[model samples]
Target chain A: MSRRLAAALRPAAAIGCALAAMAIALALLGASPLAVAADLADGAFGNWIAFTDTLARATPLVFCGLAVAVAFHGALWNIGADGQLVVGALAAGALGPALAGAPHTLAIVAIIGAGGLAGALWGGLAGWLRARRNVNEVISTIMLNFIAAQLLSWAVHGPLMEPSGAFPASRKIAAAARLHLYFAPTRLNLAMLFAVALAAVCELGLFRTVPGFELRALGRNRRASAFFGLPIARLTVGAMALSGALAGCGGAVQISAITHRLYETISPGWGYEAIAVALVARLSPLGVVPAALLFGALDNGSQAMQRADGVPAQLVYVVQALVIIVMLAFDAAAGGGWRELLEGGAPDRPDATAETCDA
Target chain B: MLEAFAASTIAMATPLLLAALGELIVERAGVINIGIEGAMLAGAFAGVAVAHATGATLAGVAAAIGGGVAINAIFAFVAVNLAVNQVVAGTAIDLLAAGVTGMLYQRIYGATGRAFTVAPMRPIALGPLARLPLIGRALFDQSALVYLAFALVPAIAWTIGRSRFGLSLRAAGERPEAADALGLGVYRLRWIALLASGALSGLGGAYLTLAYADTFVEGISAGRGYVALAVVIVGRWNAWGVAAASLMFGAAIALQFVLQAAATAIPYQLFLALPYLLTVAVLALMGGQADAPSALGEPYIRA
Candidate 1:
């Protein structure tokens, strides 16, 4: 088989296996897998409204998937994108209402920019720890995630609580800060388009730029990258900050277009879910769009499945997890190819030996 | 009030100690299972569901172990057999556990889940020791699981610090290739560590429902599993150190309830975020993996 065809088939096969396993689980639960599958398909793509809702659901995922891909490419294990997104939304939500007197376009830019900046700081903190303090990014990011969640909980209940204090939510942003829906009665908006544009930019930046090359090289072999004087610390911090900014912007867009206000739960684990998306796309920047859309459809459809078949919406999470597991297993079993790319060259490889010698 | 705080601290520390002990074993064998959280969640759900069905807490505890082992088994296959990235594999396991537990919980108990309570395990008082002043009941008069958690500290310390099996396990973690050369089966050692960790994590989860909360809730494990991971680190990869760190974190958590009840002007969220913030702060100060096993987090495939 052609390598390109093999590359394409691997993810498809993994998804197929994951769905099959879920089918067995559904059977055990006494729900007919076929019926559940049909319901999910119908709910996700049945009508124009459903399709638009899927798009809206996918918008944050696209941003998050990109964030994950960018960080992973630099071999930075950033598990705190969810926290970064939350802080970003908080920033946007806090600044949004104050932009009432500003021009509409300016208000939108400021809100998103604020979100991106906040996300960068959140992500940069982890990066700085890893670079300067030699702390594990995985642990720090996870801790940060818990901290960000508490911060959001505090914000909604305390400082950002709606004026009426009826709910644990912030006041809606000013009208000028909102991203206008392109079609009435549909959630279709410029945010999805912006997400797509960002994916294109990411694709270009990762493939066609010197910094991108440095990041990829760093990811492929950290010891070798350092030996080659690749400015390891700076690249690590920069990649993590950029990754956080992507997720943060996604949070900002969600506020601008969908929620319009901050709440205790601004993201439904989009940062974590994006890990599956990034993996399925094999960490390709451009591939994140379609991958996010697929997961988005699952999210949207699962609601309908719940209503029709008594299946819980959390079934999607199970599928997402399975996809990642199966993908990793398949790539590893296949030997070489994408596994090397994904793991950034295993230690036993020749390059690793060279790195050891250098050390 | 002071006695209550101490009691609460011990009770809270029990679960963290159990979970951290398991992680200590796994990390000592050269693998980090982020899925420890997932295992705990699986255990919590299984424990409550089984106990509720059979009206037997022991049965629930057994099921919790099985549930935890099952989740870790998937992680073991991917991270160990496939020789893939342990962190990513562990993350997937966590997601799987969360998804399966949440979906099944809703399916079995309904959306509102108002009927999901179980009779908590009765604390076992150590005869006359239970009546000795404030600290007595706080430490001695506790559930069998709580006592078991503390007892394992020395047991684990001796096993890892002095036993031949521990030497092999540490060998696997420190340098798998060298360990393999020395006739130690790195794969077997790592698998054993992961399985042991699974059981410990599951027991921790069971303690939440069967001994402490007396009910099951989605994400009741919260970030306890992750915190357990930090416990292993802050403990500096020593069993006794893990025990102390767990108690410190447990006290941090117990303080939340105490402070929240005091109703100070402080926002309750500040208290809620305390343990997590403390984890980051301590880790930052500790800095460097100077004491970490040499080959930790690396996938080793025999040549």
Candidate 2:
């Protein structure tokens, strides 16, 4: 078979394997594999609302996925996206009242920008520590996630507490700050377009720009990148900030377009799940779209499964986790990228095209 | 009030100390499992489920250890044998734990969430010592797990510091290939270290469900495992240091509880964030001084 065809067929085959595995697990748990599979499909794609829900879910995943993709490309791990997303929402929510009298378009832009800034700062904090103090990114980011969660809780319950003090959430965001919805009653909005546009921009910048070159070089080898005159510290921090900006944008868009209010808990582990999304996409900006959609389908279908099939919605996490394990293990074992996985067993292939290094 | 705070400090620190000790052992043997969070979660669920079903606290604790070891076995296979990326494998295990635990919890309880509780392990008093003045009950009156954890701190310190086996453990962590050449059996040592870590972490998880929280909730471990990682770092890879750091963190968390009870206008969330913020602050302050195992996180594959 031709390389492209084999590559295209690879993910489908891998996904099939994952599904079969999940089915066996389900069967052991006393649930019928066929019924759950049918339930998942019907829930994710059966109706217009479900389809819209999948797209809406995919929107945040795309932004967050890109966030991970960009950072991983630079060899930085932004595991704190959950925290960044929360901070983004916090920024946007805090700005809602101040923007109450502003023009609609300006208010929307400001809110989104604020969210991105908050996330950038949160993400940049980890980058700064890594570059300056040589602290590991993984532990730092995880700590930051905890801090962010507390901060969000405080914001909702204390400073931004609803006027009546009844709920741990902010007042509804100014109507003017809300994104224009494309589908009536469906949470879908122009944010989806923005997410895709930003992804396209990332794709171009990563492959076509000097800064992107620096980032990818750093990811490939820190010593080599520094040897080649890259401002290792600045690039490390900058790449982290940029990655965080995307995650912040996700938070901004979600608050502005969907929930329309900031609650105590803004995300259900979207930041961590985005790691799986980015990896499954091989950290490619373009690939993130389809990969995010797959995760999106799982999430959306999970809700359906819970409601109809009596399965817990968290089964989605199981599936995503499985995919991450298999994908990473596959990458490590084969010493190649997504294409290699799809190409069956091409051991001798150069790693030039592989998305993420084992490091 | 002071005694309550002191007692609570020990209670809160018990889990962190236990898990941090385990992680310190694993790191000393050249493996880093970020999935410590998942292992704790599995233990928590297993502990609660078994305790609830059998009405035996001891059985629940034992099951928790079994559950943790079983989960870590997967980590051992992928991270040790397959030699995959440790972070990815660890992360996958965490996600798997989250999913499977949630599914199991839901399967038992049904669609709508319901409470699952177990009788807490009764505290064991050091008879005469428990009656001492200020530090009496806080130190002498505690559960079996707390005593076990603190006792193991010294024991581990001795094992990893003075014993001949300790030399092999450090050798495995610092330079695995050399250790292998010396017939130190690097892989076997690493595997054993991980199993020990898993059992300790399982005990920590059991403490959360059966000793302190006395309940099962999704994500109940609540990043304690990660905090344990930070504790390991802040402790500078020493058993005594780990104990000190864990207690300091425990105090910080215990104060949060106190502050929340005080009902101050200060965003109570700020109080909640104290431990995490302290972790970052400690990392920043420790910088470079907090050395780690040289070969930590590298997957060992036989050539």
Candidate 3:
């Protein structure tokens, strides 16, 4: 097979292996894998409403997937995309009620823009820490995710609670700020189109821009990038900010298009799920869409599968985890970029206590 | 209030201390398992399920250890044998554990999401110490797991800081190629460290359901695993430091409970967010990876 075909086939094979593993698991749990699979498919793509819902669900994944791809491409281990998205939604939700009388277009822009900015700051905080303080991004991001979740919980239950104070949710956004559904009675909206456009823009920016080149170079060889006069600190913060903006915008879109109000659980672990999406796409900006859709279909279909086959909807998370594991194993076995993919540049930081040379 | 706070602090610190101690060993052996949270979750679920089924807390604890080890075994195969990126593989492990545990919990307990509780392990009070003043109940009156966790601190400190085996583990982490060249068996050391870490993490998970909480909830590990990761760093990768860091975090968590009960003017969410915020702030202050294992998080394959 041509290298391109082989490359394309690899992820498919990995996904296949993951499904096979899930099949065994399902069978052990006394559920027929085939029936479960059929139910999932019937639920996800069996009808127009289902298909539209899948796309809508995939929207956030697309945004967060891009966020993961951007940051991972720079070798910044950002495990806080979910946190960023939450902060973004919080910002948008907070700003949404105040935009009641504003022009429709302006209100929409303000909501999304606010979310993106909040997300940027949130992500950028970890980035700055990594750049200046030498704090590990992985740990910092995870901590930030917890903090973000608490912040949202506080918002919904306290300041942002609906006026009736009956439910732990924020007030609905103004009609002007809402991204109206394009198809009546369907969840399809302009957010999906915007996401697609952003993906294209991200692909272009990542490949065709000088800054993008610098980021990838930094990811590939951090020491070399530093030695070559690449502004390591600047690139780190910028990539993280951009990544956060993408995820934040995703959150804003969800608020504008779907939920229209804030709640404790704004995201369903989209940030972590995006890791699988980005990895399956091999951190490709353009590939995130399809990858997100695949996972989204599983997510959208899971509830139906649960009802039909006595399976839990969380089974999709198992599929996601398996896909990632299988993909990583396949890639490692195939002699792919395991080192650079994770450790970024040098595997070891210079330890003043002992080791002189690092692997 | 002081005595209650002190006891809560010790109770809260136990799980973090247990997990952090395990991670310290894993990091010392040159592999960082981000999946510690996943292992703990699996342990928590398995402990509750088995104990509920068999009416034996010991059986629950055993099952919890096995659950954690089982999760880590997959991680070991992928991270150690396959030489995959440890962080991503660990993340996958976390997700898998969450998915598996959540699914099984739902399947067995029904989809209504009712609370499930088991008989909690009884506390064993030390003879004279239990009857003493402020620190007595906090220090001497606790479940076997609490005492074991604190006891492991010095034991782990001595084992890693002084033992010949610790030397080999450090060698593997510092420079795997060099360690391999010296016949230290880097892969073997890493595998052993990961499995040991898994068991400790599992035990920590069991402590949650069997001793402290007496109930199992999905994601009950609740970022405690991550906090333990931070504890290793803040503890400066030593057992004593880990113990200290865990106590500080435990105090923060305990304080939250106390403050929440008082129903103060302050928002409860602030209290809930305290420990996580502390993790970030402490990590920022700790700054730099100067004390970290040289080959930590690096994939090492045998030649």
Q: Each candidate: what lDDT?
A: 0.89, 0.84, 0.90
Candidate with better TM-score, 1 vs 2: 1
Which pairs of residues collide in candidate 2?
none
List the candidate 3 regions with Cα displacement exceeding 4 Å: A337-339, A346-359
Per-residue C-alpha lDDT of model 1 across residues A1-359, encoded as one tens digit per residue: 98778878998999999999999999999999999999999899999999999999999999999999999888787888899999999999999888898999999999999999999999999989888777888899999999999998998999989999999999999999999998979999999889989999999998899999999988878877877788877998999899999999999999999999998888899999999999998989889999999999999999999999989888998999999999999888887765665665321111232455467
User: Which candidate do you rate higher for lDDT, 2 or 3?
Assistant: 3
Give candidate 1 misplaced runs (Cα > 4 Å): A344-359
For residue B26, give model 1's deviation from the true position in Å. 0.7
Q: TM-score, each model?
A: 0.97, 0.94, 0.97
Q: Report how far residue B301 has shifted in candidate 3, in Å.
A: 2.4
Model 3: colliding residue pairs: none
* Residue-level lDDT tens digits of model 1 in B84-155: 877778888999999999998898889766666788899999999988888988998999899999999999
> How high is the TM-score of chain A in each model?
0.95, 0.92, 0.95
Candidate topping lDDT: 3
Span of ten consecutive residues with least summed lDDT in model 3 chain A: A350-359
